[model samples]
Target chain A: MSIELEIQLVAVVVSVACSLAGVFLVLRRMALMSDAISHTVLLGIVLVFFITRDIASPFLVLGAAAMGVATVGLVEALVRTRLVREDASIGLVFPALFSIAVILITRYAGSVHLDTDAVLLGEIAFAPFRRLEVGGVDLGPRSLWVMGGVLLLNITFIALLYKELKLSTFDPGLAAALGFAPGLLHYAFMTLVSITAVGAFDAVGSILVVALMITPPATAYLLSDSLPRVLILSAVIAALAALVGFWTAWLVDASIAGCMASAAGVLFLLAFLLAPERGVIAVARRRSRQRWEFARLMLAIHLLHHEGAPDAANESRETHLGEHLRWEPKFARRVVSEAADEDLLVRLQDGRLELTETGRDSARKAMLV
Target chain B: MNPLRDLLFDYTLRTVALGAGTLGIVAGALGTYAVLRRQSLLGDAISHAALPGIVLAFILTGMKSTLVLVLGAALAGWLGTLVVMMIVRHSRLPEDSALGIVLSVFFGAGLVLLTYVQKLPDASQAGLDSFLFGQAATMLERDVVVIAVLGAIALLAVVVFWKEFKILSFDPEFGASLGMPMRSIDILLTTFLVIAIVIGLQTVGVVLMSAMVIAPAAAARQWTNSLSVMVLLSALFGAMAGVTGALISSTAQHVPTGPTIVLCATVLVLISMAFAPERGLIWAAVQRRQQRRQIRADAVLGDLYALAGHHESEHAHDVTVLEAMRAGRTDVHRALDILEERGLARRDGTGGWTITRAGRAEAEQAGESGPDGQHEREGSA
Candidate 1:
């Protein structure tokens, strides 16, 4: 494969890995924790650099992942103490750790090649240049291998504990009562999140890690209700975003990670406005339809109430219904026409509304519900 | 060698301090509402989203002015806030997810724009980098003036609409019932937050700017329940942290101004969380410890009374027996001392302890009430 293909593949794999765990994070209402962990992992990388002095050491990955887990632990501990608000704990913990990392980098390692921007805005365009060679054997890009491993680990983790995870996430009290150990599962799940965040952070920058983790899964959530479908759909959306982002970056000569995030944002906006069942437009349409249906029923019930009255014709006339029911003349005409078309009520030559059999049945049914 | 005189006379130190201080006061004062309204994460999204605006402004204007960049940042931040609100209103996604999505995606777009700008032959690279990581070393007098003007406008708006903003922050539904235009008030309040965030973005960089807004307000919250005091204290804490951090960064080699200021604000948050009188962790822990001690003491005294009743003639109980009955963590000896001090237990001639009449009465009363140390359900913010 060409270097371009390799770069895009790396983006796709890394985003896919992030979305796998993001499903749970969004479900748990801890989406901000991804932001926190992605940031604090920098502290782990910087601290480990003090010992090894080598930015490329594998230990940095381990240390950073450790810090990600530790961030969750610290946030949970603060929340457990009940002193800090849950959101405050997250907002407080990560910036302190991240600022320390930035400070350490500027103060202690200014001359080194460990650029904070590189960490915050990862250079995925250069991933293809970093080859994974073993002895004299030629291998592909190192990032592809790294991201693939993280993806595989996530798949295995989720597959092995699928039932338990689902049980705990939807109903933790029951899971704990049934001895599934939801609290332990929570930590275990967070460990996966930390590792995935660290891996994605290395590929796409810290903020894009949040974008990839949240936006894809969040978009999928609007389109589906089942867990398995959301997972599958999120990965597919992530892959599509990677392709579009890659093309945008290529055209604009920009950061690929940033472009990918922008792509995800655009896609989410589209989904937010246009999804079939849950999109804003669809929801609005359904609401307006329900309102019209309610209006038609109100007309049917009104006509039925005054069927034999002396003033029935005056009260039930399509034009006079507005004054009696407190609706606009134009709106009452539309409702009257809609009911006539549905055969729930009819407009006579005299301009009065009369409920048909189905109309009377519909009004009585609506009242029962 | 006089620090105060040097702060007044030294141009670099003075500019850095004044610029950061102005940002702190503005962000701190406005962040109180954000935190109170549970929109702290929204502030984070807005700050991150401002990055694209900064870069876009630089791109269009071909020059870097604090005013232009701040305006762009404010516009972008405001747009991001609207996106979050719309997502929450329209979708099943929680508010945090919306916050994360907008912040990361907008920041990503900013980076893309930044990269594009950097590729240009005559791009102002230094100005862009300063906005990214912040360059307190490069702060100017004009920056301080811009921050102060914007901050003053925000503060004036707050004062002008104090009751409306307060009601919007604490109870928008109630405000709506009273015929207040709540949606407009919400937008106006968020506009204040956007201005505050953009004001800080230059000094703390986009990434750490939200801390300036949230930390001071959160810390001030621990000090007071009153809205006026919280806002005042938040602004004061922001300015203090900003100046202290600026000074520290100035004196120290290679210390970036923005992160140090964030660190200073975070320190205030820590101190507030651990030591604030009514809501502090230390006080809560102390109360818990004392309550546990009282319960243990009561249980031990009750154990002694039961033992004394088991035998006739006001029989005395051995320390070993009390220890056995108390089991682990009873600290029977301390309980005995407490009972003795209270004139409830007396040491017998045989080196055993007997429950005195008053002691028997106390133990009976405790036993009748039962050892139900009711754990109250703690409500969180």
Candidate 2:
């Protein structure tokens, strides 16, 4: 395969894996923890490398996974003490560990190939050069296989624990009561997150890993309400982002990981503005719609309140709506037209609004609710 | 010569250490508000978000001056924070997600700009990358002066608005209800934080900058319960970390200055967590042990009083009955030892134990205040 193809494959697979885990993180309100894990995982890699003197040792993966879980564990411990909040705990734990790793690398391992820059902005272009050989056969980029394996592991973990994850994420107390051991599940999920984050680092840097993990799932959440739909949509969004981001990087001749994150960011912005249910536009539309309906109900209830009074005629007049409810003439006209369209109000021969039976019932119900 | 005297004499080392110290004090002060408000992660986001601004400033002006770069970073960090606040307030998405989005997107943009800058003809772009991991040794006297000036202004703002900031941090709603311009205070506080973070970016860099903002405040939090004391201690701890880290990293070859300073702050946190009075883990454990001993002794005395009441006589009873009441005899034995020390119970020297007149009176007192004991147990647990 061509180097470009290899890089694209790595980007897509890694993005999808991250998005899969990200969906649960977003749902559980632990999105920032992913950022923390991505960073502190560097410490695990550095620690393992320090001992083994081999960057490719499988032990690095184990160490990275342990470190990821440790990050969550330490954060939880801090929060349990009630001295710090969740975000504060996250901010406290990761930097300490990451700084230690950085110190170790720059001080003790200065002669080694590892450095902080590579860790921060991983080069996918160079990822194509590091090929895995099997029995003297050229097998393309090594990152592809590693990322592909992690992606597979992520899928299997999610697939097997989907029900448990959904249950525990939404109602952990109930899940615990039902013997699912939500705490254990939380640790297992965090472990997967750590492993995936470390694997993706070679293709996309740590920041982009956080981006793909959070942005795609968060975008999908804006678009979909169902868990399964959100999961599938997030994966699809991640894959598309990977492709577009790769091409943009290619065109600009810049960092592929940065471009991917930019692309994901652009996609999230689109979803934020245009998604069907929870998007900004949708929410604004809903609020406006509710406002109009509320005005109409107020009109109906006002007319009903003055039905038999001496000033009922004046109160029910179309001209009085502007003064009675203190609405603009244009706004009142729009509300009247909308009410007429909904058949909630009738205009009498006297040019005054009288609520139809349906309108009266709706106003009563709106007030009751 | 003393190390302090030696430090003051080394011109380069003195500049770097003083710069770090100033940066630390400013961050620690603002970070007290951030931590109290539970917005510690906002510092992390703003620091990461400053990268694009730094790169853009360099690209636009083609200058590598610390003041210009710091200004650019401050603007970008504030812009990113504004967007996060907008997203959180305007959308259904939570603050954490908004923070994450801004952090990554701004950082990603920064990376692209950085790479683009690197390819430009300007060879001076080398210093820009140092803003990522930070090279404190490269800090110039001009940069230190800028940091000190800004640090002093930020610290002054914190002092001037101490009461308002305290109210805003603890309960903004109450402040707002009292007709205070809470929203303005919040923005002002955030501005202080952004400025503090931007100036420190040169010394601590984007990655470890938030650590400087949060670590000292968190460590000092363990040491004190009062807000004013906490803030003062946090600044002290931050300055100590900064100076100590600069000294140690300078003495040791190959150790980066920023992370070393952060590690010193973390060590302070570890010490505070382990040894701080009242709130420390060890202290809490010791308190728990003492309470457990007291409860066990109370239970043993209560049992001996019951034995005296059951017999309708003031006679000694077999100590085996008390031992049999508990599954573990160690608790019973230890409780007996405490009871004897308090003159509440005594062994008859034939494997028998009897309640003293003082013991009966003590048990009666405990019975009268038994409800409070239950409440105390619950509170302790």
Candidate 3:
């Protein structure tokens, strides 16, 4: 396969993997944690570089995973202490760790190729430059391999622990009573999030990792209720977004990550407007249509009631049933014409619209129905 | 005297200190409500969302005044919040999810604008990039004055609405039942948070400003339970973190101000979490150990009383020390020694342990209570 196709295919796979994990993260209200972990992973990378003096060492991933766990641990500790809320704890820990990473990068500028900009916004275009070779066969990108492994790990972890995760997420108190440790499950989820975030960061950047992790799953949430469906839909959305975003970037000469995020935003907007039952436009349309039908039925009933009045012979043209309806003249005329055709109303010799006997009976039946 | 004078005279140091101090005070004060309302991340989101507004203001106005730029930023921040609220209300998406969406979209737009601004012919745009990660050294005296005035106003508003805010935050349903306008109160709170975020955006940038708001409030919570006290302490903590961050960054050249301030705030949070009274880790551990000791002493005393009664026919008035010791378990021995030392119990002529008047009173009190005595009483009564 050509390198371009291979890169695109790998991007799709990686996006799907991250987004699948993202579904659970977003549902659990851990989207910001993903952002935090992705950014703070730089500290781990930098620290590992400081010790090993090798930026490309595999130990960097390990160091990052450790830091990710530490991030979760610190945040959880702060929150449990009740000194700070969860958001505050997250707000406190990640930036400090990230700043320390930035300081380290600047302090050891000569030894490390990593910089704040690189850490904050990765260059996905450069992924194709680094190749993985197995038995003299050139693999597209080393990030692809790393991300592929992470993806496999995530699927297995999720699959094996699906019931546990579901139980814990939906009802933690019950899970605890049933001999499952909610705290352990929480940490396990965070660990998975941290690893996926780190892997996605290497492939995309911190910002894109956040966007991909949060937006697709969030969008899917708007569209579905079931957890498995949300996960599947989120993955599909992310993969599709990646492909479209990459193409848009190529066509418009914009940043690929930005385009990808924008695409996700578009998808969310679409879902927001079109999703069944809960979509804004759908709800609005349903309400409007229902109101119109109610009005029409009310107009029919009013005409029928007027026709049954005993003083109907003395009524003037201004006192006509159509005039009493007070709808738009054109709409009122249309309603009268339709009713006349249906034998529900009749146009009298005096230019007054009156309901027929059949119309009165049908209108009463409609009201009861 | 010369060193102090020189330190004070340094323009970079003085300006950074002033800027950070003002920013910190404002962020901390506003953050109290943010943390209470569970919208701490809103500050972070708004700060990031402000970037595009700043860039757009610069692009459109072709001016570099901090005032114009900050106003534009406040507008964008409020707009971002509005969008988030709309999404949350209209869709099934949760609040955090909506916030995440707004954060990324606005930040992305800001980045696009920033890149565009960079490519402009104006050299004035050169310093605009610093807003992403703030540089306190770049602040002017005017910036400090603006921040101080805004900070004062924000604090004053918080004070005026202190009761309403407290009621609304802890229990909005109660507030509403009391005929308080919850929506308006909520708007007032959000407006304050937005203004705080906008003002701090210039000094601490997007990401780090969020830390400034949340960290100090978090730290202050560890030390106090009262709302007013928490707000005051949080502001104090914030100012200290800001000043220290500025001072350290200045002393060691090239350190970015935003990250430094964030680092200081994080340190304060850590310190408070580990050491503060009432809720801190150390306090909790100490309380637990103290409770254990008390429970052990109570157990021993109760056992002694039980033993004394068991040997004697009908509620015996006194018992020998050896009889009490022989009847008690092994664990009670050490507790009995401590009780004797404290004069609660005494050793009699026959080596039987006997409860003193004080020990008898204490034993009676302890026997009336258990770990769940209050709960049982509430349930039964």
Interface RMSD for candidates 1 onward, in order? 1.1, 1.2, 1.7
Q: Write the residue-wise lDDT of candidate 3 on B1-381 in tens digits.
A: 232454489876787787888778878878887887788888878887787789889988999888889888988988988888899889877777788888876776676577567778888899887787787777888988878877787888898998888888899999999999998998888888888888887777776778888888888888888888888888888998988888877677557778888889888888988899878899888887766655566666766666656765223233344335446543566666777887877777655577777877766665678657534533442
> For this target, which candidate reaches the highest TM-score against the unseen true structure?
2
Highest-DockQ candidate: 1
Which pairs of residues collide in model 3? B320-B352, B321-B351, B321-B352, B321-B353, B322-B351, B322-B352
Query: Cα lDDT of all candidates, in order?
Result: 0.88, 0.88, 0.78
Fraction of true contacts kept, per model? 0.84, 0.74, 0.57
For all the predictions, what are the DockQ values? 0.73, 0.66, 0.57
Over A1-369, each residue of candidate 3 has an lDDT whose tens digit, in order, gives 666566676677767878888888877777788878887888888888889988789998888988988998988877776666788778888888988887767666634578666665566767778888989998668888888898898888889999988888788889999998888888887888778877877767676678888888988988889998888899899888888877876776656666777787788889988998789988999998776656556656776555547765544233453455566766666655666677766777978666677877777999785
* Cα RMSD for candidates in order: 3.8, 3.4, 4.6
By DockQ, rank the candidates, best first.
1, 2, 3
Docking class of 1: medium
Model 3 chain B lDDT-worst window of ten? B313-322
lDDT of 2 at A159: 93
TM-score of each candidate?
0.90, 0.91, 0.85
Candidate 1, residues A89-202: lDDT per residue as tens digits? 788888889999999998899899777888789988889988999996768999899899999999999999999999888888899999998878998998899889888888
